[model samples]
Target: MKMLAATLSILLATSAAAAPGDADFAKGLLKKGVAFDTVKGRGKVPAYAAYLKTVLVDGGFAASDIAIEPVGETANLHLVWKGSGKKPPIAVAGHMDVVEADPKDWIRDPFTAVEEGGYVFGRGAGDNKFDVSMVIATLVALKAEGFKPGRDIHLFLSGDEETEGVTADLQAKQAKAAGVELLLNSDGGGGGLDDAGKPVGYSLSAAEKTYADYTLTVVDPGGHSSRPTATNAIAALAAATARVAAYRFPAQINEITRASLVAAAKETPGQLGDAMRAFVANPQDATAIAMLRTDPGSVGQIGTTCVPTMVSGGHAPNALPQKAALTVNCRIFPGVTVASVRGDLERAVADPAVKVAIGQEWVSTPASPLRPDVVAAVTKAVAAAHPGITPTPAMDAGASDSVYYRALGIPSYGVSGLFMKESDAFAHGLNERIPVSAIAPALVHWRALLTELAR
Candidate 1:
């Protein structure tokens, strides 16, 4: 009778270990509005943190293995699964914060995760929340399957990626102390789809442009509109702004970008493809450069870009402004110094009176060297999920938290398995969403990656 009781107990425990399906887990996370009001300083990150803690505990992780560090209104969740301790821990990170959205501009409430047609719509659904859900699901599934990793697996979730990324900075420090080997960021790269919604290829981001903002200010004596003169502050500011706008930074190619363009050209046919091929073979080809510039997607990949994003001149329409200012945001290419870019802008203005200053301080990280082991693992996982999909290494035009890790000598690669049609993605815009089909495949891919790398 005691033996029978033990057998029944084992069966019940096994049944309890099973986790929810991938689609269900993703839907639950989307409904939480984790990114809503994230920039307003009233982010829903705390609520999301509590929910994740519960999920981990239920998935059989010891409470001591999971740590939630709250930084101001934001938070970071770290989970550790100890293994043989023979190799450095493999870290996977994704951000919970997302850009703000307004309901008036959307077909549905931006915070409410809605399923329509074949897609799931909500803020952060595509930008990052999708990866968050996938990471959580992978952890839960691993625990339920009774798999033991050959090396420790660490999962880091940051709460301020869209803002200052304070949590990521803190996490990087901790990771370095823990002797982490490498980090695979789910928030950076993924598969690109063609116009027909067919998968073109997978991209692994090895580098990213630096994001910096500068302010151009012009000050002059106050005067009435009726007494306007050539020394008008607004006019001076406008002219300087125009000169800055007309300026174009020179085009330069790096190892990662060169490889990306080459791969992209193979997938794309016709004149555009020919141009891509020509530009790689001869960077000084004017015709090839002009042809590539016709496409907005290829423009940022080739050079540094700066554009006037915000402007403010007069305080009152009837009065000549005492001071005028405009903000020019630039994405500096790798190896370019911030000071050089600022100097270029000042020279373009050609106005001694117009003061140019860095509006915000930004860190520039060098490109990480491509790791053949990482490439092989990612390729294997991609093939397991999507047969015939080719994984290519590329650099991100925008920035991500990966820069923090890369700066600390830890090579970070963006290798997310999520695939979305380019036309269907609205990451930071209204009605942000991802296809329902994209979610399950990503879960499978992440699980495979974790198994391959950790084992």
Candidate 2:
């Protein structure tokens, strides 16, 4: 019996020593290039899943505690560190799949993780892979430190989030069934930094705008371009599109956005700061709204925005087009229905010739309430990790899988502690990268947050 006990102690010590630090884990995952093809729905994701399993197992988590469920071409990795049955489990989630990257478009191969000038250049380095690595590193670090939570902590890594989010939706349902209480998603909110890389503030996203696409088409009989009729299809489509461009959705504010603006105003110095303060005090302030309109960064947070993304008209230069269409994509504010936005577009156009139809179904998700417990926990964590950086609740302009979990009645907040310059965030664009300085602080933030909430 004494020999068996000694062997178990040695095994535990070996597992604890084997856990890697946050930067090392991130480099390892980024090197795998778990790039997912939104169209084909496959990539090196299976290899990435195997990598995560190996890390967790090496961190001393039992094989039974980690479950890898395959869904189509991707898989979901769930790791549970069980605790006493006193509180519901808290789930930390990030998507494993990354958007496709072409080597020609990037300075270096997007799949290869390159460390240069205090930044990690890779495809998923910023979008989500860093967050996933942070969660894993934090959990492994906690295990190595011999810290035990009073409640279960579940790490959910979804395989499809940039495209279909099938795995996230499935896992959210599973988490709900397992009686998970709160979800801290790492894909949405984070710290915004200034030009000098100083922290502006950290945003905890409580809500996100809904995504809806609309198609406006004009149909007419084709004719010779030399003898074109007044009722040209292409011309009508162009006119309709112009009206949409000229139209602006009304500016609106909610509790979360109000707080965000208020926090931002405090940090800002000049007219921008004054404008933020005015808008927060009186959301109907036209002067402040006009000033904010000039700054693209501030405008998106205050109102629903619609813009024409795609347009196609003439088939031949010699003939009048028979049909012309434009795709209008809108990031809708919370609580607004897609039908209402469609009605607004139809009214704005006011022409019977152009037909506006829904290109995709709107998925509605209610905004998460700013629960005091969550706010306090996040605030405390931010204070510990980043002194003097205020924690502000925000509403994200882009949609995330958190909406699905929010729809399921589990309030999910985006609490990623990464701080980076807005100009450096090339997510879904060319040559994505993350600051090396941002990584260690993120690990500290996650560790502090998990300890605060679960312990």
Candidate 3:
């Protein structure tokens, strides 16, 4: 009887160890992430801060270990977990803020945690809340298993990343000062399905295009509407806009993007994969680019892109305006600088009648080299959990908080290990939500990554 009881106890422990709280814990954290959005402003700050407090408490972390550091205008919440060994810590970070979403547009309240059709629908569900929850879930599960990391693990969740990345920037500076060895920002861009619905994941963003806003001004002396003035301000602005629309920043391959394209090519299917292979094998071939350009995804890999976003230059229906302007937002390539993009715009609108000046510059530093240690850790973890999908090193065309750490010379990967299907809210679109099926696999991916990297 004694031996039988001991055997039963061991089996119970093993089952608990093997099975992490996939449902209750994830649901609880997802609810927390969604509810905290209410604390966006006014009383929102305290509300969000309180939510973090709840997360730390529920995750079995001591309140004393949770530190809130105020940087400039915003404060970053830090949760530190000490491991058994003495190695430097790896920082896993995510922003707490969610972009404004119209409640009317959503089928359910954007702030309310809605579990319907195997999805948790909300504003930050895919963009970052999902990642935030993943970290909490892993930590909670690890704590239950009495699993201590060999290295100190610091999880930093910033207050504001939606508007500007100021808080995230400050957090990176602070992390580096505190001696964080590896930084992972889980803010934007990740899982997408191929045309056949096969899950494809992008790991460690190698490079991101910098965002620069250019304002083009065309000025003409005001004249009566009946007189039909020549060379009107609106007309000049339109001509310049057309020129910019027609202009294309020449294609040039950078180190990281080239590596990413090669990896993606290996994974891509059908003729697209063939063209990708051909381009990587021979970049000089004009046909490679022309063929890749036929598909939208490949165009971003080889070029700097520009799109005219906003225009404001008209005065009145009856009067010819004296001044007109349009805003052109450009996402510059990795090797290309903001100055080079500006120069390209100037050459495109060379007519003396138009004047161009940079309005707002969001500069992104070049990507860091893929650290083999981190990559191998993530790759091993992913392969163990998902047999068929091979982890690939890639670059994101969209920007993320990862750029801030990369700027500080810290090895950063935009890794969440969460598989998200293609959806608009993945960035700034509506009805954004992560699927239920992805939740379990993501947990396994993150858990493996944490365990491997901690060692």
Top TM-score hit: 2
| lDDT, candidate 3, 13-117, per-residue tens | 877643335755676677667865632442353456557767667668898988776644456788889876568878998877788888888778888878888
Q: What is the lDDT for 148 in model 2?
A: 82
Residue 284, model 3: lDDT of 72
**TM-score for predicted model 2 compared with the true structure:** 0.88
Cα-based TM-score, every candidate: 0.88, 0.88, 0.86
- How far in Å is the alpha carbon of 131 misplaced in model 3? 1.4
Please list the C-alpha lDDT of all candidates, in the order they appear.
Answer: 0.84, 0.84, 0.75
Report residue 435 deviation for candidate 1 (angstroms): 2.2
lDDT of 2 by residue, 346-367 (tens): 9999999999999875466778
In model 3, the runs with Cα more than 4 Å from the true position are: 1-21, 42-45, 70-75, 83-86, 193-202, 225-231, 266-274, 423-427
- For residue 177, give model 2's deviation from the true position in Å: 1.6
lDDT of 1 at 190: 89
